[model samples]
Structures are given as C-alpha cells and as structure tokens.
Target: MTSAPGTYDAAAEAIAARLASGGAAARIAAASSLFARGDAIPHERRAVMDLACAYLRLHPGRDADGEPAFDADDESVRREILHQIRERFLASSGDRWDHQQIPLTLARTYLPDVDLSKVHIRSDRFLSGAWVAGDVELSHATIECGDAEHLATLDDDRPHFQLTGEEGDLHFEAERAAGSVSLFDQLRCHSIDGVGVTVRGGRVRVSGHIGAVRLPVLTATQGVSISGLVGCSFVGLLGSDLKGEVSIDLEPALSAVDISWSAVHGDVSIFGMALDHGAARVAIHLERLTVKALHLGGARVSTCDLAELEADQVTVRECDIDELRLDGALVDGGTIEYSRIGRLSVDDATLGPSWVRDDPPARVDWLGDESRETVIGLNIVGSTTEVPPQGLIDNDCVGTMGDLLLDGFPVPLRRDSGTARSGAK
Candidate 1:
C-alpha cells in the first residue's frame, strides 16, 4: 500500500514483525498461532483493530532520503497487519464480528479508532464483512488496491479470494480510483455510493443487499456486476458490464433504477419486487444497451427496455424497447419503439390498459401482497431498430423517457412520443 501513514502500536507491530520474519509457510504458522489464542471480547478485539488502523493512518508511504518507501519488508508488514484484521476482526467464512453489538452510528464502535483526519486505511481487509459504525470515505483519492501476493494470504476459506463479504450498516463512497474490488459473498449494508469511480475489475453476486445504493459514472472492466440488489437508487450505468439474473424481493422497495451507456453480458431477468411507500419518486429506465434477454415477471418498471421482455401482472408505461420478443407476456399501455426484434411474439398474455393501474400506486401504496408488485399501464411502438422499412407503430411513434425509479417519480418524463402512455394518466 502506497501513500499510507504508518504508526504501529505494540500489538500491530508485534504481528507485523512475525509476518516479516519468515516466508508464506512461516507466516501461516504465525497466523495459526495468533488465532489459537481464541477470541477476545468484541470491544477488546475491535480496539486491537483500532490500534492497527491507527498505525495505518499514520504510516508515511516514502522515506526521507527518497529511497524505496515502504520497502519489501515494510510492504510485507503492512500486508500482515491487514491479514490480522481480516482474520480476527472482519468476517471470513462468516462475519461473527460485533455488528449486532455495535450501534449504526459511525465511529461509535465499528472501526472505532479510524483516524480519517490523520491517515486513510490502506488495506484490503475492509473487503470482508465489518460492522463499521461510521461512514467510510475513499472519495476523490487514488485507491491503490492491495496486490496479489498480499491478497493471497487473506483467503481463509477459498484460494486467491481477496474479498469475501461485508455485514452491518455501511456507508462507502468511492471516486477516482485504480485497481479493483470484489464482493464475493453476502453483504448487508444500508448505503453504497460509487459516484464517478473507475474500478479495473469487480464482481457483485446476487445475494448482496443495500439501501440507498447509488452509482454514477462508474466504469469497470470485464467481469463487473451489481446483481440482485434489494433497494436503492442506481443513478446511471456508464461503461459497466453487468452480468446476472436479478430478483428484487425486499420490503423497503427499489428506488430510482436507471441503466444507460452500459453493456449486459447476459440476460437481465427481473422478478418479484415492490416499491417502498416512503419513496419520493419511483421508476425504472433502460436506454442504449445491447443485451441478450429481458424477462420480467411480477414487477413494476417505468417504460424502459430494448429487447425480448416478457411480463405478467407487471405495471409499466410508455415502454420503449429494441429487439423485443414477448412470449406469454402482457402489454397494457406500453410501446415497443426502436427495437431489433424481427418478430414480436406475445402468447397467453393480456394486451390493453393495466388491470391494476386504474389507481396509481404510490411508493408506500403499492397494490400487491408481501411477495409481488403490481404493474399498471403499458404502450409499445417501433422507434429505432427491428423494423422493416416501416415501424410497428405509426410515424408519430416518438416518446421521451422519464426519470429513474423512486427518486425521479414526482418528476414527469420529457419524451419524444406523440402518443404518451403514463400510468398517472
């Protein structure tokens, strides 16, 4: 780790010295010896972590003579410190930390002594589950992620898995960074802000749940995904490659979800989701994407998508799609504009105004049981691609798109469609 502030305490320094002494085998023995002492009290253990974190915060990346700062030995010591925190403090196979015991407020308990004002935490241990009782900031800084050799020692359960999971109420905001991060297990956090952040590589499984999740101008390479999110505002997807089948089955409901200027490596399947009543604006949008399949069932999204969408009992309005292939899907007051589908097949599906949208459903007033959400209106018209000289709709088949789901709701959509179809109507 570069540009770190190192001030090691007795406990942290002792562990670092042990790790620096021997090779991987010797270090493994040292680690085994450390854990063999058994677990300490939650507060006591976190204090040890705080002491180590304090050291990291105070570490200076370079030396006075302009020589190699944090030499091989120093880097090894830093890596050992991170490994200690991960094995003893953060969650591995499971995060048995003090999340349940700590308060949600930052700095009260979670990483309690993190001296952000003094130094930043330059370790990969945070990728694992931790009950941070405070806000974490990697914003507007160059986040040089931990490297491979150091990351190799962190895999408690698997091989070469640097990140395993995260637990508790988390507030992570990242911007302008190099390197990568991976979410390898279930994460339960209330907030994750990744605005204008660029990650070289990342992986998000379908099991993570966070509230108020926001990502704008986020770019990642290859295997990048944010799948199966519970509820949050996904502002925009820029140069991100999402891969997975998503299912929204949570209570707080999904917020403004917008997807634009992105690529989907596989099918985007949405099923079983509802809107939270407390949400200010609510909607979903999909623009400028070249995806494979879109299967929607028991969901509610604002008119958005461009290819092969199948749905039932789902409420939508002014849907503009490309490559639309509907089989056993319903079409209420939605439009199929600018699609590449040569033939649109709708079988065993309803076609007309939504049976549920007679009354608008507010975020809190969604009309459905605990398990499913209800769709209201729908409209379809050929706009851009998937047409034979003439579009599926009339020449006046132009419409503007609305804001994303949840936050952008109360705001009306500014579309180019002469035939506007909104559930509010």
Candidate 2:
C-alpha cells in the first residue's frame, strides 16, 4: 500500500511486511520505530487493527496438539507488543491511550494470552464463547460499556461468555472501574483474583465452575451476585464495602467461605453451602459483618462464626449447623427454625423482637417456639441482654443448657413445664 509521507497507511504496510517476513528481533525493531513515530503519522483505527492482526498472525501460538501453547516467554513478548501498539502507535499526539474507544468483539474464537493492564477503554467489549489460552491481566484497567441499548439487545439464551484461562488465572487486582460487567450464563476460569477492585455503578454476576475466587478489599456500589459455584475450593470476600445486595449460592461440597469485616447495605443471602467435613473441618467465617438482613437456607456447615455481627434480622431455616456462635452481636431479631444445631452460643449479645412489620402478620419461629427445631447444647452466659417480655419466652431446649443466663426478667425453661428461672449464673 503506497501512501503519502507520515500516513497511517504507510506505517501499516511497513509494520505488516516486517512482521510477516523478518525475524523476531527484526520485527521488534520495526515495530519500535513505527510506534515511536506516532507524532508524525495520523492515528487511524484501521491501521491499529491491521497491525494487531498482523502481529497475532505472526505468533499463531499453537502447539503440535492443535492447542494454544501459552508459553511464558512468548506471553511476555506478546504483552510488550500489544502495549507498544496501544500506547504509541494507536495514540494521538499529546494524548494518552486511556481515552480511546476500542470496541472489540471476538465471539466463538480462539485467542492466545491477553494483557490489557493499565489500559482504559470507553467502549463495549463482547467475548462470548471466546476461549483464552493463558492468563488475562486486567490489573489497573478501566472497562466501560456505554452502549446499554446494544447490551440489552443481546439474546439471553446465548452462550455464556467464556474467559477460560487454560494455563493461568485471571488477574483483576486494583481495577479502576468495571462498568456493567455481565458474564452471562457462566465463567470457566481456573481462578479469579480481584483484590482491591472498585466497581462504581455496575453489578458483577458470575455463575459456573471456578477453582477459587479471592476478592478481598473490594468496593462495589451496586450489588454482586455469584451462584452455581460447583467444587470451588475457597471464596474470600474479606474486607469489602458493598452498598447493595450480595447473594452467593454455593454447592454442598464447598471448602470454605469468608466474608469477614464487610458491610452491605442490602440483604445478604447464602444458599446451599457447606464446609469441608474431613479431618481439617473448615468453617464459614462471618465475623464483624454488618448487613440489613441475613438469610441462610439449606446450609450444612461444620461451624458458623457469626461473632460481632450487626444486623436488623437474621434467619437460619432448614440448616444443619454443628456450631452457631453469636458472641458480641447486636441483632434486632433472628430465628433458627426447623434446623438441627449441635451447639448454640449467645455470649455477650443483645437480641430483640422483629422490627419488620408484615401486612398479613409474621410467623413465630424463634428459639423454643412452635417450630420443629432441635438445639443440642445451648449457652446464654456472660451478661447477655434480651428484650423484655417477648424475649426467651418458650424454652424448648432438647439437649443441655449450660446456663440460663439473662440480665433482667425471669425466663421459662420449657413450654410444657412452668419453671420461671432468674439468672442461673
């Protein structure tokens, strides 16, 4: 392609020819020269796409088994190439590449390792069914999807966008803005590390088989819904500040789930979760968590650490918990109905009646209520305070009570027997 001096067409031809014919070193030299000459040439999207395609064609990255090689050294070189292409060749004079609209769509395709770290994109990206060979480094990147109408036009029944890191994990640490990230049916990655990520006004939904997920120190203004995690070893959401609802639905055989030191403004629901029952006996950690309401259903965990929790209401229905700890918690009301709890501890906690008012009236499902709940060992010692009159009304303890320790009024021990006891220290 012949063009005038300092034209994008000329630069494109030069880069393409060098990548097609020259060796690796020669190709690098050519790309460097052209990329550094960004101030002289005009920035054209076609030229950028053509150069990227040429470089990808040069490194097809397939092994003898017809699979992506994903070699470490090759990935390093690819990262450098793409970085130079985006930063120098595609950027205009006196402008960083962060203010670029690079809309990309590669559905049902095969891609090698990708590194978009530190890049900012102001466009929609669709990678539905795209199989990535290696790691996807998105650390410090800003992804925005401005086309809400276009996103709404996508078919719901379409295949879930696949970001399978066959050889490596997905790195999302220190991300700036993840605008409207919707991973439709499921995501199949080896693992996801989203430490120190910030999602300003968008929601994050991922449902599928993931090896592990660590999203500690996250800040999300909107909600986060992650479900259908089958055989995932661990899920860590520690030290997060979520301003919306949080829902996590796990399988029965999960190892551990930790959401300590987090604050959620909306309801938090966890369903179908359990801990490892082997020799180690991993447990679920919810220490120092604050939420509006918490609901746990169909859970069979070894231990539930609900110490220092601040919530308006908490309900644990249809659960088979080995140990339920509520030490130093300030909860307005809670119910443990229709469950088999091994041990229930309420040391140094404040419990009250339900503040939620239903139109048709709510069902009475507290401890020792009409529900078919069975608590083996109950402990209410160490200066615990319950609301007057309505608190500890029906003492339906099927097992042993360590101490019927209360602050103010005398409480009954059983519904069948009229035994009013006062502070059995």
Candidate 3:
C-alpha cells in the first residue's frame, strides 16, 4: 500500500513498529516486504532517512544509548535490511540527495554500483573496505565535516581541510571495477584513501582540495589527471601504473608529491606547482619513473630527484629549484632553458644533446666517479659558474663552438688518448 503525500511520519512509524515486533528472521522479512512494494516507499530523501534511522536503531553502537542490544545474527539481519533498502528502494531513484545528513555509518559494507553524482552530503561518509561492482561516479559530490563551527574558528592561513578523528573525514577506500571514477568539480572532502582500489579501466580524474590523498598502490588502466588542488599536504601515487598520460597541477603550495616507481605510457606534465617552504623539505620524487616525455615548468621546489628516470625527452622551463638531480637517468634529449637552479648533478647519466642555460650561474657537477667508455654530449651556454673539471670523464660539446660559450669564453674541448673530454661546455 502506498503512503499518501506528507505521510512520511506515518510510514516511519509503521516501519519502526514492524521491526520492533520481530526477531532477526521476522525483521528481515519485514524489510523485504517494506522495500518490495516500490509504491510503499516514500520520496528518495525521506525513504533514505527513515530507513537509515531504523537501521541504526537496530544496530546501535556504544554512542547510541537506550537502544535494544542485538546479537551477531541480528547484526547480519540489519545488514540485509540496509542492502535491500539501498538496492531496491534508493538505487533506482533519479533524485539527488542534496543537503541531507546521512546517519548511516557504512564501513565495511558491500555496495552495489550506484550513481552518487552531485550528492551534497552534510556529514561524514565512511566506506572503508567496501567492494563496488562497477563505476563510482562521484563528480560534483561533496562530503562536508559535521563540525563546521569549530573549523571556522581556526586560523585562515593554516590548513583547515586537514581533518582528524573518524567523525570529521570521508573515508572512501572502496575497491571498484573497470569503470571510470570521476572525482572532480569542486568535490570538497577532508581526506580520501584509495590504497586498496584498483581501477582496471577508464580515467581517474581527481581535482579540488581533498586533503592528504593517499592512492599509493592504485593501478589505473587508463591515465589519471589531478589538478587545481589548494592547501593539499600530500599526494602519494607510488608504485602506480597509469597506462596513459599523467598530468598534475597543484596551486599555491603542497608538502610533498611522490610518483616514484610508476610507469606512464604517455607524456607526464607537472606544471604550476609550488612546494610549501614552511613545511619540511621533500623532493618531487620521480625516481625509477619511466615516462614517454617529462615536462616541468613554473614549479618552485626545494629538490627534484630524477635518479634512474627513463624518459625520451626532458624539458625544464621557468622553474626555481634548489637541486635537480639527474644521476643514473637515461634520457634521450633534455633542455634546462630559462630556469634558476642551485645545483645540477648529472653523474653517471646517459643523456643526449642537453642545453643548460640557467640564471645566476648554476653549479654543474657532470663528472662521474670513474671515466666513461663513451663521451657525453653537453652544451652549456650563458653565465654559469663553478664548473670544476678535476674528475671529468669522456664529455664533449654538443652544438657548435659558438653555442658552447660559458662566461663569454669558448670552452676548451680537449682529447686525451683518443677520448673526447670537456668542461662546462
């Protein structure tokens, strides 16, 4: 039987009475009967709220006082009831549950493929250890902290989105299938954990300020793009295989960004990013990363560790970095034009024709511990200083003599025992 309009209270009272009169089996039967009749369920909003309240009432935790205690079998029955309500009553609804407080603590639950797009949840949503069958479309959805008044009293310069405690964050550690995960468009949340997730297909586009996102072991078949993040502390994508282009752009500042041991088939672009100087110093790690082309621009960081990087083309433009280590890198072509770096180390690297023209004279350390079998082609132009040649190996000038001028003097290209050796050219 369908409840009349504006009879949400009556429907909720009926559900409470029916569940109160039954044990585990009877309650499960009541849940099945209540959700089986689609017309008996109220609007999506009221139906979700009432059903969630009933579910919490049955499976009350330590905070829920004056509620009837249930055994393990009753707990299983409560999960079944929630599953029926989610799959049958709410999944088919096209309405967006906006500006509502979802009281269900959905941790460790098995969720079906559902569209929560544009849903504005005004509370914490915990989905840790949940397994999803298909795509998780969370584009334009927001999960706000329940304690807003306390957040407003904090300092503005500090990172307000860095939230702690279980009740103040959105825990989404669900494992999804080979469907696209869209987490962009002002999707504000305290933090997210996708470490246990593996996206077998579709692009994983993540934007907005989701504080301290940890997706270290995520394996996305398609590429991933993360941009427009503000006040983000950390972004961990270690040991991930993004089979397509990997693009990342962070605004203002961040603590650290690591993509070590990752492989990308397409070009990797990291621009418009600046590390926070107030926080501890952490390099933008690209160690052992294999990419098609690597581009770095408009970034101001303390250190950029590119040791053991395998890239076809490496380009650095308009950046202010303290140290740029290219040790053990296997790059085909590289250019450091129009940048200011404190120290540039290229020890034991097999790089093709590279041009180093940095402002304020960057220190170039291109000498390996021992002599190399083959000569390294390096073209250094502009006013770079402190180019010591005590431990120079087989190094030669890349371009013409005019293009290898350092301090307005042509660098001496000498030959020792039929092996070409040069200094700062």
Candidate 4:
C-alpha cells in the first residue's frame, strides 16, 4: 500500500510488533491497529479509524497537497485489510464498540467530534457493502445504489445495520431529491416529513412503521413509486406532474392531503384531500377516498364523491364509482356505470356526452343501491319542444320550410299529411 511520504516506518513497526506477539489478543489489536497513540488502545484509535475510513472512502481523488489521499487503488492491500477486518467483525456483528469523541477527515476538511451532520454518498463513492451503526440524518440528500440488480446486493438483514440517535430523535426525510436511494429491507426512522417531495427516479419500499407519510411531487421527466404504510396525518403534493403509480396503505383515516398533477394513477386511501386549483390537475384512474369532506380550489378530476365536494370545474371519466359519487358533477365526456354507483347526488353539474347512452334496461340501472332514490330532474326555459314520459325535450327544427316544430321530440313522432302541407315539412 502507498503511504504518505516518510510515513511508512511507523505502520511497518506497528504491524511487526503485533506479529511478534502472535495470539488472539494480538490478532484483535492488529485488525484495528494504527500508527498513532494517545492515552489508551481503543480510545485514540477511534480518530484514526474515522480518518482512515473517510480517507479510504474518498480515495483515488487527490488531496490538497496533490498526493494520493488513500490507497484504495491498491486492490491487493485494500482487499487484504478488508478481508481481515470482516472476518473479525462479522463473527460478532452485533457487538457494539463505544467510540468516544473522534475526528473525521473528509477530503481536506477535518471535522472534529462530528454530530448531527448529514453525509451524502454519491454514485461514485457508494461502496458495494457499507455499514453504519450511529444515527444518520439524511434530509433531501441523494444516496444512490444504482440499478435494482446492483441495489439488491446490500445486506440490510445484518445485525450491524442499525442507525439510531444518541437522544432518540433521528429523522430521515427525502423530500424533493433528484437521484435514488434503495433500502433493500426495513429502514427504521423515528420520523419522516415528505411535504411536496419530488421523487425524480427509483422506487422506495419500506416494511417498517413510519411516523408520517406524504405524497411525492412528480414531473414529466421523472417517476416515483412507494409500497408502504404511513401513520402521519399531514401530507402535501404540490407543483409535481405525477406520471407513475403512488400506492399507499394508511390507517383507514387521514387528516390532510394536497394534490396537483395530471399524471396520477393507482390506488390511494385517504380521509380527505385539499386539492389545488391553480396547478393541481389529476386524471384519477383508480382511487378510494373516504373523509369528512373534500375541498378543491383549482383542479380537475376524472371521478370523485359528490357530497362535501366543491370545485370550479372537476372532471369525472369512465371508472367504477361508489358511495357519495359525483358522476355528473364535472366532466366533458366519460362513461358512467350506474350499477356500481352508490348514494350519488349532483348540483350545477355539466353532464358528459358519454353518460347519456341508450340501455335496454333503465340507464339509471347502473346507479348503485345507495342512489336508487336519486331523481334526475331538469328544467329548460325559452324553448318549444316535444316531451317524453321522463322529461321534456326542446325540438325546433328549421329547414327550407323556415320553422318546423315537432310535437314529440324525445318520444316517437308520426308524419302528418296536413302538417306537411302547412310548410312544417
């Protein structure tokens, strides 16, 4: 291994001294041996380990003095040292080492007694097998592990993969980051706050309990996905153009939700959602929302509930609908399966052309059991037209005859010879 100028003798002497002792204690001491000494064995070496690990992690990059900072390029030495250390530590992986105040040398900066600071592991610096025990605060930092195949190599089941704070208040919030972070198994964080978080790439799956959950903001250029259960109440998704699926399982009730995008898909179970009108636009492919109320400021939806729903203009497309449905509330054109509907009601709604289809049974047959009592009422003014058994239809046909009015427009009409000769043909 390459050493920093004139520093070879001390390392060589240390290794030689351990070899001469030749025993289990000597082996243990040798595995963590360093060239410097300060009061005791393990206490002083903590600083050396921190510096060496940080230096090794940032190897290949030149130091401020233009010298090779670490010997990572030397595969033989790195492999030998790593193998020895792994063999020693892996045997008793759960063993905890109480490391006191230590200094970390990152690049050229020497951080003394680092605490509560965040570290970012970029794509190039991410080693294949990395381990940590202490709490790590990662809020909006990018930690990439590359593709799914390469990402699966992480051994999260190992007993040493713990990360907890000294005071028991650690948090991991990845809100609005551009890269990817793959936690193969369970990642336990005390609290997570993802408000308007933009996830541009990768998939996140957690099998553990989380303090809170929030919707991710997506763009046309990126995609995000999550499969987990969230326990928090406050969540926001603003200024994001979602194009992928966002699947979430919550505790049957939610407090707040904000959505603004058009490319949202999949299933979401929430108590309520506060939709944005200025920029919020989503074509709901499949959604199940049950809350006390819903407020939409500036937005459009493919389908939603009718009760406690208020918006400037909302859109409801073709999808299986249910209780408190807003089928005719706001939509340009879409199919409505009334058989699947339940407890539906509408006021000042714009009917979709696709909803007025001819059916052998009553078109209202599709309205679910809850809405069986709902009546479709209409009142039109300033028009003359024929009427049907259900309602009146305005029919004013003008041809070369100028004005020809039909007696029955919505109902069947019969041609009259007398009326034909009266310029009503």
TM-score winner among the candidates? 2
What stretches of model 4 exceed 4 Å from their correct place?
Answer: 1-145, 150-190, 195-198, 215-222, 226-235, 261-332, 335-352, 356-425
What is the RMSD of candidate 2?
A: 8.8
Mark the 10 consecutive residues where model 2 has the least summed lDDT.
169-178
Ranking by TM-score: 2, 3, 1, 4
Q: What is the C-alpha RMSD of each candidate to the true structure, in Å?
A: 16.8, 8.8, 14.1, 18.5
- Model 2 agreement with the true structure over 1-425: per-residue lDDT tens digits: 43442124544555545544435576566666555544344444424433443344333457899865655544544555666645732323356533333343322333454455445444332333334564344444444444455443432222211112333322211111223455322444555565565555456565555666777876767767878775567777899888889998866546688989999889888876333223233477899999999998767777888899999888886566778777788888766655566665666677665522122113324333523434422222223454332234334444222233334333434646443355444
* Model 4 lDDT tens row, 43-100: 4343333323432332333568883333322333333333332322221334322211
What TM-score against the true fold does each predicted structure earn? 0.38, 0.65, 0.49, 0.35
TM-score of 4: 0.35
Ranking by lDDT: 2, 3, 1, 4
Ranked by TM-score, the better of candidates 1 and 4 is 1
The window of 10 residues in a row where model 3 has the poorest summed lDDT is: 154-163
Global CA lDDT computed for model 2: 0.54
Better of 1 and 3 by lDDT: 3
Give a tens-digit lDDT track for model 3, residues 1-425: 44443233455445544554556777677666655533344343434344433344332333267523445555656666645534432323564233333322343343333344334443233343333233344333333333334322321222111112223332212112112134343334455555434444346566654565667756666677888766567777887778788888855656677898988889888886333333344458899999999998767767898988999888886565677877777887766644545556665566654444333222222212211211223343221234432322223322211122222333344543333334444
Task: For candidate 1, write residues 1-425 as lDDT tens digits.
Answer: 11112122345335534433555566455544443322433333433343343333322234587522444543444455545544443323254344322211121112321212112223322333432222333222112234535344332221110111122222221111123344312344555555544433234332354554455454433333455555444434544455433323322356455555556655554443323334332344544443554444433444334322322323323222222333333333343322112123332333444222223233322332421121122233322222221112221322223221211112223334543222331
Each candidate's number of clashing pairs is: 50, 0, 0, 13
Error of 2 at 393 (Å): 5.9
